[model samples]
Target: MASKKKRVKLKSLSQGRPPTLKPLHSLSSKATRTLISSHHTLQKLRAKAVAEGDEAKADAIAKEIEERGGIEKYQHASLLGQSSDRGGDSSRILMDWLVPIVPALKQHASDGRQMRMLEIGALSTTNACSNSRLFEMERIDLNSQAAGIKQQDFMTRPLPNDTKDKFDIISLSLVLNYVPDAIGRGEMLLRTLEFLKIPHHLDSGCQEIFPSLYLVLPAPCITNSRYLDESKLEMIMDSLGYIMVKKKLSNKLVYYLWRRVSFSTKRTCFKKVEIRSGKDRNNFSIVLK
Candidate 1:
C-alpha cells in the first residue's frame, strides 16, 4: 500500500487574506534588532531626563529623536510590524479600500506611462497594493526580510524624477502612528507630497482624475492624541491640495481615501471655527459630519 501523503494545513482564506507569515521580530535581521535596541536605550534616557526635570536634556533627546526620524525610528516595521495593529485588520481594511479605487486608476499608458505605486511600510507582502496588480510597484520598509521589500527610509528618499507622474497611487498603511508627534506627522505629509500626480489636463473636463492615497493610521491620532485629530488632518491635507474621498474610524485604525482635487473646490467633512474669549481662548466650534 502506498504511504499516505501528509498535507500542510493552511490558515483560513475565506476572507481573501494573505497567508500569515512568521512574527515580524523573528523575521527581522540583525541590523533591524540593533536599531530597535538603540532606540529603546534612547527612550529610557528620555524618560529619565523627563523624570529628573531636566528640561534641557529632554529637549536634546527630543531633538535627537526627531533627527533620527522621531519615534518612527524605533516603532517602525523594524520593531512592531503589524503586531501594533488590531488583529492585523489593517491589511483587510487597506485591501478593501484599494480594490474600489482600481477602476479609478488611469487605464492607458501614453508615452509608456504605465501605472506605478509606492507602498511604504509594506510588511512581508509581495502584492502590496493588491488592487493595482498591473502597477510597477515599489515596496519599502525598515524591517521585515520580506522578498522585494527594500530596507529604505521613505522620509528622506528623494521622490522619483525620471518618471514624471509615473505613480498613480501611494499606500501608507499603519505607518504614520510610528512618528513621535503631530509636527513630525505633518512633516511626513509634506515630504510625501511630491509623489502624487496633479494633472494640468483638468481644463479639458477629463473624467480621469489624478492619483490618490490609501492611508491608515492609529485611531488615537484622530480621536485622542494630543497633537493629531480629524480636524487637524483635514486642515493639513486641504492645505496640501488633497481632500478626503472616504474615511473610516475603526476601533483601532483611522483609514482615509484622499484624492487630488482643486483646492478651491475642496469640501472638508469636518469644519470648525476657533472662537476666542476676552484676552483668552474659547473652545472650537463643532460642526460634525
Candidate 2:
C-alpha cells in the first residue's frame, strides 16, 4: 500500500546562474497590465482564426502588424536593448557612421554585368533608378521586408556569390545612420563592392570595372539638418579617388554623383565641369565634349 514514490526532476542553479524559481508578484504597472491583456486577446483571436481556417482574418492581422509600425519599432527596440544611444534619427545616425568609408567602396567595385550596383540601406534607390535609363539598379538592405531587397547583414555577412560583377552603380541613400558602429558601416560598403567583383574573371573576362557611385547625405549648413557636409564629404571622396561629377540639394537632402577619376574614359565624360583660372579669371565649364 505504501509502495511507490515518484521522482521529480529539479533544475540546477550554478555559481553564475540566478535562481530559476521566484514568487509571482502583483506589482505590474498599468502599462504592463494593458500590454499583457492585449497580448492575450491577440493570441486568443489568432488561435481561433487559425483553428477555423480563417485565412482572411489572419492576413488582416498580419497587415495590422505592419501598418501599426510594429516592425520598425521592434528594430528600434532591439537597437536600444543593445545599449545604443543613437536616439530616434536612425537614418542620420547611419549616414554619419558611413561617410568616412566611401573611398574604399569606390576602389573595389567590379564591372562584369551591364551594371554593378549595391544600394546600401536603400529601399527607394531601386525605385529611383527605375526612372534612370543609364544604370541598372540593385537594392541591398538589412530589412527583410524591403521589396526586391537582398536580406543580408551588410556589417557581418559576406556578399552573395551571385551578386559579383552584377551591378554598375552603387548608391547609399540615407542608410548609414541606422548602424551603431561607424567602422562596421564602412566595412559593409567595402564588402558590398568586393562582393560585386567576385564572380568575374580578372583580366580577359571583365577586369571588374569600378562602378560609379551616388551618395546622398544631409546638408550641414542648415540648422538641425540631418545631411552630411558637402565640402567635407567631397574631400573624403576625393581622397578615395572619386571625383564629384554632380552636386545638388533638395530640401534637407544633398546628393553627390561621384566617379573614380582613374577609371574615367573619354566616353564617360562628366555632364558639368568647373574650371577656375588664374587671378581675375574664374570660369564655369559645361562639358559639351
Candidate 3:
C-alpha cells in the first residue's frame, strides 16, 4: 500500500487575529479581500439588528466592528487593493470606456465649464478621472480616507435641484453591494437618477456623451446569484430609463455604462424572485419596490 499522504491545512483567515489587525503595508491580497468582505458583512448584520430593534445585537456587532479595527482598516484594505502591484485601480476601466467619448466631452466642456462627476465610494483622489482635465470630480465616501474625499453618505446627500448641481457622470463602483438589504440597494439605484444631469442630446461616439452611470459590481453578484443575472439587471435598468451602452465582464467583476435615455419612466415593481437554482449560488439580489 502506498504510504498515506500527509496533508497540511492552511490556516483560515479568521482563525487568528483579524486580518485588519495586521499592518497595512504587510497585508496580502487575500488578507485585504478578507478584511473588506468581513467589514461589509458586519455592517449588514448591524443594519439588520438595528432595524429589528435589537439594541443588544446591534451593540455587539458594533463592538466586533471596533475590534476589527473599524472602517479605517477596511478603507486601508481597499486602498491597498488599488495599488499598482494588486490591480492598479478601478478608474483604469472607467478611463478606457471614456476614451472614445473624450472629444465629445471636450466639445461640451468648451463653454468654460468642465464636465462634473460624482464618484461615490471613492478611495483615491489621484485616479484616472481625477487626473483628467475634462472632468471636475466630487469624491465622496461614508468614511474619508484622504484629504480630498469628503466624508458623506451618498444616500443622504441632498438631491440636486438644478442641472448645475447634478453630475454629468455618476460612478458607483463597488457601492451597491455595500448596501445591507435588497430594498436599500433598490433605493440606491433609484436615487442615482436624481443626481445625474438631464441629457440634452446624444453626442458622436461608440457611446453617447449624455448623462450616464458608471456602475461596477462583483461579477458573482449577477453571475452566481439565485435572484439576479444579466437579464434581470438589464430589465431593472430598462425600467429605470437606463439603456446599457457598454459592458465588460471579468472573472471577478462586471462593469457597465448605462445612459439615461428616458427620464420619465415610472418605476417597475421588482420583487426578490429566484432566477437560478443551485446549492452554491449566492443570495445577492436587488428589489425595486
Best by TM-score: 3
- Which prediction has more favorable TM-score, 1 or 3? 3
1-289: candidate 3 lDDT, tens digit per residue: 8444332221211111122333355688999889888887887777666666666767788889878887678778888888999876777888887887788777867966677899999998898889876788899987767899997878778888788899888999988887777877888898889999776655566237458899999899999999999999999999988999889898888999898888876789999999899899988899998
Residue range with the least summed lDDT across 10 consecutive positions in model 2: 10-19
Order the candidate numbers by lDDT, best to worst: 3, 1, 2
Q: What TM-score does candidate 3 reach?
A: 0.88
| Better by TM-score, candidate 2 or 1 | 1
lDDT of each: 0.54, 0.40, 0.80
**What is candidate 2's CA lDDT for residue 184?**
32
After best superposition, candidate 2 residue 257: deviation in angstroms? 1.2
Per-residue accuracy of model 2 over 1-289 as CA lDDT, tens digit each:
6433332211110110111222222223443334323432443344344344565665565455444333343333333322323222323332343344434333333332334456665444324344332334555555544566676555544446565444545666544333322233343334434443322343331232344466654443212322223443454455445667656665645566665544222232222222322353322111212
Against the true structure, candidate 3 has what lDDT? 0.80
List, residue by residue over 1-289, the lDDT tens digit for candidate 1.
9444332221111111111223333435454556555654565455545545565766787667556555444445343444443144365565565464444344443335556678877765544354435566778865535688877767756666854744566878866654432334455665566776654453122223346677886565466543345767777687767788778887756888777665343334434433222333322122323
lDDT at position 72, candidate 2: 41
User: Which ten-residue region of model 3 has the weakest summed lDDT?
Assistant: 9-18
lDDT head-to-head 2 vs 3, winner: 3
Q: Show where candidate 3 strays beyond 4 Å.
A: 1-23
lDDT winner, 1 or 3: 3
| lDDT over C-alpha atoms for residue 111 of model 1 | 35
